[model samples]
Target: MSAITLEIDGNKVQVTDGMTVLEAADNAGIFIPTLCHHDKLEPFGGCRLCIVEVEERGWTKMVVSCVYLAAEGLVVRTRSDKVDRIRKTILELLLAHAPDAEVLKELAQEYGADKDRFEKDPSFCIHCGLCVRYCAEVKQKFAVGFVDRGIRKEISFIPEIAARECNACKECFPLCPTSYLQAAFVLTESLAFPAQQKKSE
Candidate 1:
């Protein structure tokens, strides 16, 4: 395969053609923050957290590095004051929407974001679709699908009750970027199976 040379954070790096900016950064030891992207799955470009300033057509524009393929002579800036501020704002917004989301909280803390300017929403789920994608594409189980649209959309198994088409494989739960599914499972198991056994007659 051919190689593409790009400048990332003023560092010259060469990556295989068709590789995304994020992949090139990884190879070059430059860290780029991301939330909706996973190495095991295809880039969905849902979250703008991985946004990077790219020099294109003589203009620098913010682009999601996970989905934007690196090209020869491409200039990519992964870290800059503008990029950092944007990333912090995005993390803050996501945290406000899902305060209890551990993964989101960690990301916010990582970026030193201490305040959430946006109004808080009780409903969780940032709508990254990691769970849905993992189930359908990786696990080959289309048991769960997103219901409703926009703000009301959420992931749930078919029938919503009947034995859960989940197959109890625990695949979707782990792939979820947020802690919602995994936390719920732990709570359910604790309630369903009490550690202390009752005295038998």
Candidate 2:
């Protein structure tokens, strides 16, 4: 593939074609924070933590670097006062769901985000879709999926498939930002997959 040159935080980088700005920045040794991006999965851009400023042809706009395609002559700024403010707001929103997540805590410190900025919700999931996508894309299990929508949306395991596939393939558990995947799995085992639970016991 041909090379694409771009400027990330004043550092010129040449990356392979089809690489996203996040990947390009990473290869160039520039730090860009992200919550919903993983190398093994397609770009989901759910967390909005890798937002960056891109300027080309005298126009500037903000985009999630994980999904934004890298291009020749593109100018990217991973962090600016405006970028930090946006990230701080996103972190504050996520922190409300997972106040104790160490990853969020560290980013919150860097961006000055208050964990209590939003009202507390019992669900600790930030809804990054890591587990859902990993199970479907990488594992091909389709065991876990999303339920509901908008304000009420959350992840859930489909007990029929999960009961048979999850325990043996718990690879996605560690990808959770708040460790909520394990809890969700345990709850599903108790509530949705009770037949299997009783048999196992």
Best by TM-score: 2
- Record all residue pairs in model 2 with backbone atoms less than 3 Å apart, i.e. clashing: none
**TM-scores of the candidates in the order shown:** 0.83, 0.95
Q: What lDDT tens digits, residue by residue, belong to model 2 across residues 13-128?
A: 99999999999999999989998999999999999999999998889999999999999999999989999999999999898889999899999999999988899875888999
How badly does each model clash, as a count of residue pairs? 0, 0
lDDT of 1 by residue, 43-97 (tens): 9987789999999668898999999999999999988888888899888888776
Whole-model lDDT per candidate: 0.76, 0.92
Candidate 1 lDDT trough over 10 residues, lowest sum:
192-201
- What lDDT score goes with residue 178 in model 1? 67
What TM-score does prediction 2 earn?
A: 0.95
Clashing pairs in 1: none
